[model samples]
Target: MIADPEGTVLALFAAFCRIGACIMVLPGFSSFRVPVQIRLFIAVAVSMALLPVMWDSIYPRVQGGGSNYLLLVGVEMLIGVTMGLIARYIVLAMQFAGTGISMAIGFNAAPGGGLLEAEPEGHITAFISFTVLFVLFLSDFHHMVIAALVRSYSFMPVGADFDPRMALMTLTDTLAGAFMLALRLASPFLVYGLIFNLSIGMVNKLSPQIPVYFISIPFILFGGLILLYFGSQSFFTLFVNGFEPLYLGLP
Candidate 1:
């Protein structure tokens, strides 16, 4: 055992700074619906799991006490938060596309409770979002997240000054990729909405008395649900496949 228990505890806290921050924002664990105490304990557990491996690098740094040590702690927390943000952006993209899908199919409904937040969503949209998340869990994506966290020490070594510019670039790239992914997932719905609306416009032009939009609503909703039903499996498969590669981007 280490001779100085105080120093050891401080070293462990240094490790916790990263792991806890990451867990607080990571996909499944980050949900506000999750109790804070549970998340905190999970972070502590993960920190303990990682400490043996990280001790050599982190312990020495804690010994040199000063403002610099505090700065290291702050930077470690920032890096952890940034990594968590990288993961969060993907979920945002999924939600974005799901919302677009809801609107495209005229499935908009009043805001309701959700796993992450209470927000406006259709039944189908909520289902898709929940299913995607569930599938990610079933696929052991959390394990992937933990693996990436382990690998992060090598990329942003303990006590090293993490570059703000690098963080900015990483965040920028993650956003860009996530946006493009959202567009891809929602494109079919976009096209469907466009074509369906345009056709409705033409029918209205030909018959001015008809409640074309009202009548077309049923058709559009029906068609959209059919498309969604057939495509759901592939849609989720595509998302899960893209997640890890985008997450473990060029480091």
Candidate 2:
């Protein structure tokens, strides 16, 4: 095919804009460690590879006045950002679960940086979140993300009026799911904390002079660690399983 220099360059730039927006927030790609140059190159490459297929659909919509081109580009960026955030929420849910578990087990100290962020997290919760994210990548869950990106064009074409209702609904549903998943992952810790607390309360009642706070704190921490070691794999498996359905539902 004869190359039309102007069309080719515009198409590439449009694709780059769409993809750069996506990589900026998408999990894995969004990680702090990924150098900006590498991310830029990947975005450009992916956009270009997909360009021929998307050009006919995207270009016509973006052409005309410069203002119209900018508007279309902004809409594409919005679509990419929305999808990336939705996928990233799954990881956030796992982190939230870790935080909840930490609070329950008495390891409420702040979490160290690595997988999710440098903020405080329950030790086990952090571990589980990191593990689940790793497994998601290993299991080829990212393929679903690429599929969704392609499918998004059909529902949210370039130059079409952006729908705030769908975006709001997407955020609400994903956030709700993330919270529920966090609670589910931390259920074991929750149960352990409840039983341990109840038993400690009874002991305190029986012996008023005993200092239960210091003693029970260590006991709960140890028990939580043990439970985490044993149950984490299963918890992450369930988490990854849950992610699949939620991801497929995204527009």
The candidate maximizing lDDT is 1
Count of clashes, each model = 0, 4
Residue pairs in clash, model 1: none
lDDT of 1 by residue, 1-251 (tens): 76988778888999999989888888878777789999999999989998988888788888856788899899999999999999888888888888898889887667577756556565766686778778989999888888888888888987899899999998889998888877888888889998999999999999999999789999998888899988888888888888887888843
lDDT for every model? 0.85, 0.79
TM-score of 2: 0.91
Each model's TM-score, in the order given? Answer: 0.94, 0.91
What RMSD does each model have against the real structure?
Answer: 1.6, 2.1
Q: For candidate 2, lDDT tens digit of each residue in 1-251?
A: 74566656766677677677877888877777778888888888888888888888766655443777777777778878888888888788777777778888998776566656655555666677668778988988767877777777787776787788999899789988878877887888999999999999999999989999999999999988899888877887788788877776733
